[model samples]
Target chain A: MLEKTGLPTDDDLKKVIPDKERLAKGAVVIIECFQKIPCDPCAISCQFGAIKPFKDINDLPQVDFNKCTGCGICISACPGLAIFVIDNNYSENKALIKLPYEMLPLPEKGKEVYALDRAGKIVSKAKVVRVQKIKNKTNIISISVHKNMAMKVRSIKVEDKKNEG
Target chain B: MKKTNLAIIGGGPAGLSAAICAASSGAKITLIDDSLELGGQLIKQTHKFFGSKKQFAGIRGIEIAKNLLQEIKKYKNIELIGNATVTGYYEDGILTIVQGSNGDIFIKLLPDRIIVATGASENMLTFVNNDLPGVYGAGAVQTLMNLYGVVPGNNVLMVGAGNIGLIVSYQLLQAGIKVEAIVEALPRIGGYLVHASKIRRLGVPIYTSHSLKEVYGNDGVEKAVISEINKDFEFIPGTEKELKVDTVCLAVGLSPLSDLLWQAGCQMKYIAELGGYVALRDDHMKSSLDNIYIAGDVAGIEEASSAMLEGKIAGLNAAVSLGYRVDNFLELNRNLRKELEELRANPLSEKVKIGLEKALLKREVDQ
Candidate 1:
């Protein structure tokens, strides 16, 4: 018998996805922390208190969209690299996405990168707008992709050395 | 025989924290490790940790090791010794440690209190061609890729779906290594869902109810074959599929290294939940043997965070036994236990609870 595999499905995504109004407002946090594990660095990293304190360590984090300023500090603070900030209001045809990146040869600002979805398939072309290496642990990289690709994109393709050469 | 107040067997997170805490409590501490540098497995863990700030959350494991090493250096009473292996623990708190590469140097230490924190060893799956050179432990892969910057192989087949398997799969991607697949005999992912999600999102297929049946190669691992298994873990007929891969990484499980505990005559019991035979210890981490304590994986296999907490408790209590007045010992112990409880309260921690209960039951029986 097949059992629950733990990967997020569309149904699971619906639970943590920001509302239409919040998504349209341009800045929102999408927490993909599906498991009830003992982790809460995201809550403490949020300066606006948007991420509520977990009643229990295994409790799912609740995000008050109103208080969330989308400062993106929690992007790097998340040990799981599951917290993401998306802004649909970047432009009429583009959206901004900030993800935790930890690979070497960090992507540079204004560089073109391939945005990959949950399955790691290249979904759209994206441009790196910002790369912040905080405390040399989790690096927060913000990229601008097509508005429709904002919700689908999770990571940027790291250029392989051999491929680069 | 030189006398010391305390002798800590391992210098990983547990031993490092114990050395710092014990030394701070006025006990002369001698911390010895088998590695050239300290930080046991922490040296290879590149991912950030999750916990409260008090536990140094948001910090990478490598950074945590560096910070702990720096903190331990502050105490003049604690002596840090690397490249030393504790060969044996004998009667009267005597420890025979062989130092140097050739094991030529022998040092006999007689400490009033001994803390066994000698971590654990990775478990390997038994199968055809399992002895091939390319077949490596998941920890060895991390040590090679993350620590030594050597790519384990171009293509890898991870043979476990636990935290180590999932985390190593992600790290393999970080090192630009391709993970062909992860085959687990369990019906579902055994680790945290977040870890499984991370690797799944990276397009790594996790095959549950599947087991690595054979590793095919002559000089090294050239390919691997997996098959579906039944509830009894018996391989189903006509379900085998060969995976083209160069490396077969095993993350089956970890067995606690409790040889010294047994040699020292500490009461040991076979507890499957604790991942093998473990020394019986009270909540204070003191074994049935007087002045001998156990912590970290040596006591039971658990996360680094819990191991560090166990080390601190054992260290504080050991100091107290050594006539050191630890002002906040009780309060600190209570808080540490609370934090450990919080970390272990998840539904997935039911097994951990069972393991802890078995170990604790033995402790009560001994008392």
Candidate 2:
């Protein structure tokens, strides 16, 4: 995919790579998590088999960016409250992180939300730019956050979120 | 790809039953199986299964398969393709199957609909010295003795108290092999109490809360070590004991082969109770993909009778997709669902039901 798009590093997901720079050249990393329990779904949910589950099921995911193609497919595949899609290659200092949002009255297009990271830390505010309906009927809301928080924020919480009825 | 009305994979009782069901509906079927002759695991099973009349309970496995095949002979639309192994599956119902019996020739199938009935295989456990040659799967032992008429080993230590282990142990004794003991990791035997009592009557010891810790042998299993566990499943160190044995049989459990469905982009969920990754499907056995259906162990590891019902459902649904509709498939499905629920209600099938519930991951999807 990188070759056709004239990008540098492009490798199949399953094959292992050594250099970190090569891993992140044009990859679109996605981490999908559901619960607060520690998990690494982005690591194990990659179909290209690019990511590896770091240690135990509780470990945080570290993506090999070079192998990712910015595909948001894994956004919904993740069973955990982890996985998000980050595409910094497009748009200025803002990047998109597609995280899972399963609440009813699901976030509408252009709605504002809070972006949270691995430790449920609010790194930055985000806005819903796109809403995705998955095969399993779950909704994923893609949020655009500051480029700095792209790697950290893998999920979103509706502002003043109420329990899903 | 060769297009047929229906393509049934695996030739076990479930597959054959589905074939008969589909063929009865006047749809052409291509029965593809990897073995030279198609009876699947049933060919190695010499024991009779227990179930209701619909399941042909009390009938030997071999005879069940045979009777299903005889019924298939009556269906002119069904085509028998034995010795064929499905290697890969792609979109648009295209199947990449290798015909091993025909000199490794590749057979591409573009059936209007597909039913995967690939059944479960015995699960092997990892323990100290478990790689010993005398250690074998319970199914492997059954295949060896019943099919090849060969004794696996003289004195055997059964590593599980499930139906497979206990039944195979009894079969081993029938073939003149001695069963030293049946050691279970759980405090309770997982199989029917009747089966356990039968083995006990024959002087075979049933050790509950005991687990196989190690085995010793020169080149193959010859001796076994066991330790008892407390209520918490933690082994009691002082309760360790050793027994002289030649062979070890594992009937820990069975895992379904649902990889083909996974490869076909079928939605799957890991419900530990279900044994492994099971494809998500609805009441009609239809998966996320409309044209693709799952049956037998691939749906969720269960008995052949349920698999047969699932197969019938899949085949009938496929027929409906192929322009053949049943008059009252809905009513028949309702009845089938009731029967299946009852069958799964058995003590032996409770785990299987739990697994099925987990596989679906939804409680009320059974409408």
Candidate 3:
């Protein structure tokens, strides 16, 4: 399904998503990597040992949700940009999602942007909460969206004034 | 004529790694490259590499080039010659090199050992008006944008959805350029699903089972016509779609640049899986010729990580053959081979593994 549409299927997400108790607890990391490729930066960059050591370099990353503090350090380290951190307990009706942002002209903190789902459709309007730029150019952006849309929203589109119709 | 222990042609990842490895064993190495800069294609790669830490995974290719150059600088025995192209490898054991902006100067070297890591060249697609002024290869696009900081065009129609196409499409978006679409002949994307997902989530559409029918323009590219292809790669009638775009990028594939090897009289085999004709070499990267070695894409088309490992193997063996002392030679050789095996263990590398099997020659007797 992923090869056909270029979007991970629901079945793929079910294997990596944290359970209800872990979601209710606090922030945690979710690795969306599906295929086996020779990549291990997520395992090497984890400071808390949440991501288990790879027996082989080609093994997909497996994270122990209980050990993960959702610090978002490994978000930018993923070469495929397939890692994210979500805090379902951010507020009564809102959740915080930290995703890798690599496009130019970084959106300002607290700016409102269109939150997009895995299929790249605008699902809801979200507010940018934090913008952390690291030396490697893969910046980390934190956005606040409705609690129900947390899992669906995976990217953002900064509304350009010139492109507005 | 000047002489050295080893001469490496091409200052790309493969040649640079070979120089570092051989120089560490106290062998005098002369590394030559045609480009003014030393990194070859690695200099233009902006995306992070995928592999373990030994290959600099998670680091950008541009950064890896810098690191390799820095490593080469620490070894005083390795001399770098940039903007110099090795013209021919003579049967009399002499290599003719042409340097200078106009290629007026000529120099000859008679090294005890030679390691050819000339890399590969991009393959072009055949379609009507494909030679238009605006048409470009994926490597050209990367060189223009990542190296020279010049955007190729406002909008681009990409052909071939392999890793190069997908990564270039993402890079185009990063540079604030618009990607019209990506067309691949295969029904499924040939690149990693994650790379496709990266651009898909950014609002780029990848059309599978589609091939570029043609491009039309007076002086430059104005539009592209694409149609769905069947299992045999033939276009399906009445399924044509036209897209408005200014540029077209071809990322079909690459063929090994093994001209020097052919000239040097190394046993060659035409392996389609390896991208083209590649030199047959032993486990240690030694060619049929006693003092000649091959590594990287020159031996077979593979990822930069594998190229680096091959360069290490070739360099170590080349130096050892020249009677240079290396600490724990067998252990080092075994570890390098094991790392290479691990790198190619994934299913994605199946094609490369098969190609390597055919290109690798078995020793009749251990030297």
The estimated TM-scores of all candidates read 0.95, 0.66, 0.98
Show the lowest summed lDDT stretch of 10 residues, model 3 chain B: B358-367
lDDT by residue (B49-74, candidate 1, tens digit) is: 76667777778899999999999989
Segments of candidate 2 deviating more than 4 angstroms? A1-165, B101-103, B361-367
lDDT for each residue of candidate 2 in B1-367, tens digit (9 for 90 to 100): 5888888988887788788877867888999888876778777765555455566654567787888878888888999887888888886568888886555688788888888888887787878999989989998898899888999999999988876777787688667678898888876676644345445534577787888888998888878998998888777989998999989899898887887888988889887777788888877787887778888877877667677778777777778778786778778768877767666654456666777765552335556
Which candidate, 1 or 3, has the higher TM-score? 3
C-alpha RMSD of candidate 1: 2.2
Clashing pairs in 1: A26-A87
Docking outcome class, model 1: medium
True contacts kept of each: 0.58, 0.00, 0.72
Kindly report which residue stretches of model 1 are placed more than 4 angstroms away from their true locations once superposed. Answer: A1-6, A159-161, B361-367
The two-chain DockQ for each candidate, comma-separated, is 0.57, 0.01, 0.81
CA error at residue B233 for candidate 3, angstroms: 0.3
Score candidate 3 by DockQ: 0.81
Q: Which candidate, 2 or 3, has the higher DockQ?
A: 3
